[model samples]
Each structure stands twice: as C-alpha cells, then as structure tokens.
Target: MMTDSADEKPTETVAERGMWGNFRRWLGRGEDDLQDRLFALDDAIAHHPSTAINYVLRGECYLQIGYNQLAERDFEQALELGRSALARSAWGFGAQVAQDRAVRGLRIARRR
Candidate 1:
C-alpha cells in the first residue's frame, strides 16, 4: 500500500467528478444557472448548518442576486462561526447601502 504524502494531490473518482461536473460547466454559463447552483448550496447548508464556509459562499451568492437582507444575515452567521475577516469585508460592502456601524467596527478590528 502507498502512503499519503503532503505533496501528493488527492485523486477524485469518476463518480465524484460526474456529480459536480455539470455545476463546473454551468458556473460560466449565466446568472440563472448560477442561481440554481446557489439554491442547491443553500439546501446543502440546511443539511450541514455548522459549516461556516457554506454560509460565506451563500452570502456571496445572495449579494450577487441582490438579496441584501439575506446576505447580511448569512454574513453575520458566518462571523459568529469564526470567519471574522471575510464576514467583516462583506459587512463593509453592505454598509455602503445602509451605513451600518459594521464598517467602523471592521476598521477598528483590523487595527488590532
């Protein structure tokens, strides 16, 4: 048996590739397809609520779709789940619209 090494890339099975192959192709297609992928991601998040990256990714998708409220909510959740810098950046962007204190807090946080 071969030992796993740090420099070795993980090999993906054909089944695993097939599962997400369409999604990879659809990413560059159009907004509608992208939205479909986002919805699927949201469903995945529902099943795995503890995954912080999912919230961050879905927050970005919400921003792209002009769902500012949902984006803000997801970003806050991500922040609570330990994604401080990214969540602060998202909050700063949203603050441009609402002028929330999150922008100020983000600057203060970055100073330290």
Candidate 2:
C-alpha cells in the first residue's frame, strides 16, 4: 500500500506553471468582482437565449469588465428582445425591467 504525503504538492493540470499563484490572484478578487459573475451569466444566456433579462445582466457584466463594444451589443440585443416581448404582450413587468437595464447599459457603454 502507498500513502500520499500531506506536504507533497498536488499534480498541476490547469496550468503547469504558476497555477497556485493564479488561484491566489483569483481569490484576491473582491466578492463584487464581475469576472467570475460573467461566466455564470454567460451560461445563463446560452441556456436562455431568448431571455431579455439575461442579456441585460451579461451586458452589465461586460460593462464592468471594460468591454464596451461587447456591452453595447448585448444591451442592444436585450432592448430588441424586450421590445418584441412587449409588442406581443407576453412579458409585462419583466420586459419593462429588461428595457430599463438595457437602456442604462447602453448609455454607459456609449459614454465609455
């Protein structure tokens, strides 16, 4: 039988070099950091492509990450989706929120 030592470092896979350093850097980011939030929002948008709110959320994430062009595109898409939903009367308050968020995101993106 073989036993692993506690002092031994685990094998690296994600990155051969500076993996722990990278992890430490990632951990140093604040709770409100948008980099991690962006990934979750990306998956949400992927699964719910027609959801206007997801687009608005992702747009805000992009805005926080300083990706102005991407933020603008997402905001525009959210606005379009919200408008269509309202036109069909399919979404009431939800569509209004999406439109409002998209408008705010667009304004900030354009300003940057």
Candidate 3:
C-alpha cells in the first residue's frame, strides 16, 4: 500500500502543471500561458476521449477570454460529458453543475 506524505508529488501532474497560469493569462495578469495548457489538454482529451473535466475547464477559459462561440461549444461538450458521468455515478453532481453552466453560456451568447 502507498502512503501519502507532505513532500510527495501528486501523481496527476498534468492537472498541477500551472492550470491557473492560463487563467491568469486570460485575465491579463500573466503571460501567454493558455496555448501550452490548451495543447496539453487537447492531447489529453485525444488520448482519453471520455474526459469531461477538461471540457468544463476549457469552456470556462474560453468564456473568460471572450471566445463566446468556442466557450459555448466547450460548455455543450461539458454538459454531455457530465451527463455520461452522472449516468455512471448515482451520486454525481458534476452533471447538474455542467448543465447550469451550459445554460448560462447560452444566455451569454444570446445577449451578444
């Protein structure tokens, strides 16, 4: 059995690799960190086509940076993925949250 320690690096390195760096960039608070994270996320999704968290995060990033169309697509994708996830887990909340977000994104698009 493996035991976690304070100094131990997390196994999910991709998630820890400066995701906020991209968010900061979107806010004009940092350098162009999105391209690299987006590329990595794209590759990860290609490898694991059923992953939904990536879609939600990408959608949020797109919205934050004013890419409404792209954000809508991502939010839609996230909703679908959230649905699938919900189907697989009886106690899942991600589906509801994703659905709410998608609805909000659609509203934003309508206002534009």
Q: How accurate is candidate 3 locally (lDDT)?
A: 0.65
Whole-model lDDT per candidate: 0.54, 0.76, 0.65
List of clashing residue pairs for candidate 1 = none
* Candidate 2 accuracy as lDDT: 0.76
- After superposing candidate 1, which stretches have Cα over 4 Å from the reference? 1-29, 83-112
* Model 2 residue 86 distance off true place after TM-score fit, in angstroms: 0.6
- Report the C-alpha lDDT of model 2 over 14-85, residue by residue, as the tens digit: 233343443343333455766665765675566568879878877877776799999999999999999988
Point out the worst 10-residue segment of candidate 1 by lDDT: 97-106
- Comparing candidate 1 with candidate 3, which one achieves the higher TM-score? 3
Better of 1 and 3 by lDDT: 3
Candidate 3 to truth, TM? 0.59
lDDT of 1 by residue, 1-112 (tens): 2336877877543344453563464255467677776865666577657545556566666666667677677766665654444456745453333233333333333343
**Pairing residues by index, what is the TM-score of model 1?**
0.48
Q: Per-residue CA lDDT of candidate 3, range 24-50, in tens? A: 433342337666556656755665567
Clashes of each: 0, 0, 0
Error of 1 at 22 (Å): 9.9
Which candidate comes out best when scored by lDDT?
A: 2
TM-score for each model: 0.48, 0.68, 0.59
Which regions of candidate 3 are displaced past 4 Å? 1-31, 95-97
Error of 3 at 55 (Å): 0.9
Clashes of 3: 0
